[model samples]
Target: MATRRDPITWFDALNVVLLTMVAAACVIPMIHVTALSFSSEGAILSGRVSLLPVGFQLQGYRTVLESAAMMRALGFTVYLTILGTSVNVMITALGAYPLAKPDLVGRRLIWLLILFTMFFSGGLIPIFMVVRALGLLDTVWALILPGMIATFNLILMKTYFSGIPTSLAESARMDGASEIGILMRIILPLSTPIIATLTLFYGVGHWNQFFLALIYIQDPDKYTLQLRLQQLITDGIGYGPTVVFGQADDIPVESVKAGAIMFATAPVLIAFPFLQRHFVKGALIGSLKE
Candidate 1:
C-alpha cells in the first residue's frame, strides 16, 4: 500500500520562489539584450538602457538586415538547416533501426565499433586530410557528412526503437515483409516522438552552425547566418559620430551584438516547444515493450 504524504508545505513555497528567481536570472539578460538592441547609440554609450528598450529606433535592425552578405548567409543557413535535417533523419533512422534489434547479424560487433568510435575519434587534422582527399573542401557536403550521425542521438534513437514490441516485428516478418518495409510501414509511423526529437536536434544544430561553415565554406556567399552575425559583431564596432538625421551615425556595438544574438536564437526558441513535446514519450519508450 502507498504511504500517505503530507500536503504542500512551507518548503514548497520556498521552492517556487527559488525557481522563479532562477527563471528571472536567465530571462533578465535576454530582456536586457533586446532592450539594448533597440536603444540609441547615445543611451547605450551612457549605459542607460535596461529591461525596457530606450531611444526606440529601428536603426540597428536596419543595419543588420541591409547587408547583401548577411542576406546571402541567411539564405544558405536556411538551406543548410533543411538539407542537414533531412540527411540526419535518414542516417539516424537507418543506423538506429538495425542497432535496435538484438537478432541482427554481427549486432554486438557493430555496436562495439560504434561505441568505440564514441569513446575515441580521429582528430581534426585526420578528418581534414580525409575531406581534402575526398575533395569535399569548401563544399556544403563537407559540413553535412562530417558530423551527421551524432553518436548520442543515434543511441537515443536505438534505445527508443528497441522499445517497440517484438511481436509486431514478428508479425510483420510472418507476413513476408522485408526489414525495410517493416521499418517504413510499422516502426516510423509509431516513432513520432523520437522522429520529432531528432528533427529538432538536427535542425537547431544546422541553423546555428558557425564553426563548420568557417572551416568548410570559403565563399562569402555560402556563409551561414551565425557566421555573418559574428562578422557584424566583430567588424561593425565603432564609437558614435554626430551625423545628421539623413546620414547614418555609428550605432552602439552592444545593440548590434544583441540583435545578432536575437537573430541567432529566435528560430530555436520558436522550434523548441514542438520538439520538447516528443521527449517524455520517446525517452521512456523501452519501459512498456510487449
Candidate 2:
C-alpha cells in the first residue's frame, strides 16, 4: 500500500499567505523608494523605476549631503536623540524603581496620577505655554523635556521591576548597600532586557521628532532631521513654497526626498538588530504577574 500524504492545514496556508502579503506590503515600498532615490530624474519622472534603479547615480545622496541646511538639521537631530534618550532612560529607571516596591508609601496615588496623564493632558497650547514659560522654547531642552518619561514605558518598567524578588532588595539593604547602590549593582544588572527595550523606544521617538521642533523652534538651523525632511518633501513636491529656496531646484526633488527618508531611517534599522533579543525578552516580562 502507498503511504498517504498529509494534507496542508487551511489555517496554516492562510497564515502563510497573509504574512507574506504583509511583509511585501512593507518591504516593497522601501525597495521602490530606494530604487527611485538612486535612479536618474528622467527615469523617475517617466515611471521607469521600481524595485530596481534605472540609470543608477548618486546624485540624490550628493545633493542631500552637500546642502549645509540638511547637514545642520542632521547634526541637531543626532544631538537631540542622544541627549533626549539618555534623559528618558535615566528618569524612567529612577522613577520606576520606587513605584515597583510594595512597601513604598503613597505609591498608588503616584501611579494613579501618572496613569491619569495617559488619558488626559493639559492640551497643546498649555504645553507650548509651559515650554515657553520655562525658557525652553527654541532650545534643545524643548525637544527633550516635554516628553521626558512616557507613561506606558514607566508603567511597563515598574511592572517588570515588580516581578523581581523583593528579597533581592532586602538582602542588598542588609549587606550595607544604599538604594542607589542596589539599583546600580543589583536591580539594573537584572533589568537589562527592559532597559534596552526602553532605550530603543526613546531613541526612536527622539529621532523622529518633528511637531515639537516645528512649534517651538524658529531657527532653520535648529530643525531636526525629520522636520527638514518634511520640509524637503512638501516643498519639493510643491505642497507649498520651499523653506530654503534655490537649493532644492537643482536636485531631482523626488530622489532627494527618498534619500532623506533612507538617511533618517537607517540608524534606527541598524541599531534595532543588536537590541532585538532584549526587546523580545522584555516585552513579555510583566503580562501574567499580578
Candidate 3:
C-alpha cells in the first residue's frame, strides 16, 4: 500500500547522518557524567574514566545520603513536587475547561486576558510584592503559588478540548448532565493524554526549581535539593576552615555532588518511559488549534 522512495537522494542521506551525529553528541555527555559520578576523583582527574568508570564505586550515593542538609533538602523537593504538581493540574484544568467552551459568556475577554499575561507582565517586583503581601514568602507555598498555572499550558489544554467533538459534550447535556457532569464524564476521560504530558512538564519544572527557593527561603533547613546541591558544589573547598566537612566514614565530596545530580534527575527520567504512551498523543494536543 506504501510507495517506495528512491534511496539516492543526497540531502536525505546527509540528513540521516547529521541526525545520528546529533544524537551521539547529545547522549555522549550524559554518558560521561554518569560514568564520572561513579568514578573516584583521582580516576577522573587522571583521565582514567570514560564512558565507563575506571574504578566502580557506590560511595557517591552514600555520601549524598549521609548529609543532614542534603537529605532534608531532598525530602522538601519531593514534597514540593508532589504537592505543587497536584495544584497545577487541578487549577489549570478548571481554568482551561470554561475557556475551551465556545458558548461560555465573555470567553473572548477572558482568553485575551490570559494571553496578555502570557506576553506581558507586571515584572518581578510586583509578583514578589504580591507574594509577600499574601505572606507566602519564605514558606513552601511561595514556590508553588507563583507558577501554579501557566498560560501557555492552559492554551494547549484548551486547544485539546476544542478538538474533542462538541457533540460528545452536547449529548451529555441532552441526557440531563450538568456542566460539571459533562466535564467530569465526557471531557476528562478523553483528555488523559494531554493531562499526562502537562503533568510531566509541570512536575519537572517543580523538581528543577531554584530561583524562587533561593530568593524566598532563607532558612537553611527549608532549602530545596537544587539549592542544597548548589551549595554543595560551590561550598566545595570553601565551607572549610573549621570543618573537614565529610565525616571520615562518608564518601568523597565530589562523588557526592555527582551523585546528587544523578539522583535528582533519576525520577524525572524514569517517569518519562511510564508516560511515553501519553507523550505520543500529546504531540497532537495543540496541533489542531488555529
By lDDT, the better pick of 1 and 2 is 2
As for lDDT, the candidate ahead, 1 or 3, is 3
lDDT of each: 0.79, 0.85, 0.80
Residue 176's lDDT in candidate 1:
100
TM-score of each: 0.88, 0.92, 0.89
Q: What is the lDDT of candidate 1?
A: 0.79
RMSD of each: 4.3, 3.5, 3.0
Q: After TM-score superposition, what is the CA distance of residue 266 in candidate 2 from its true location, in Å?
A: 1.2
Cα lDDT, model 1, residue 84: 92
Instruction: Give candidate 1 misplaced runs (Cα > 4 Å).
Output: 1-4, 7-10, 234-253, 280-290
Q: Which residue runs of candidate 2 sit more than 4 Å off their true CA positions?
A: 1-7, 235-246, 286-290
List the pairs of residues colliding in candidate 2. none
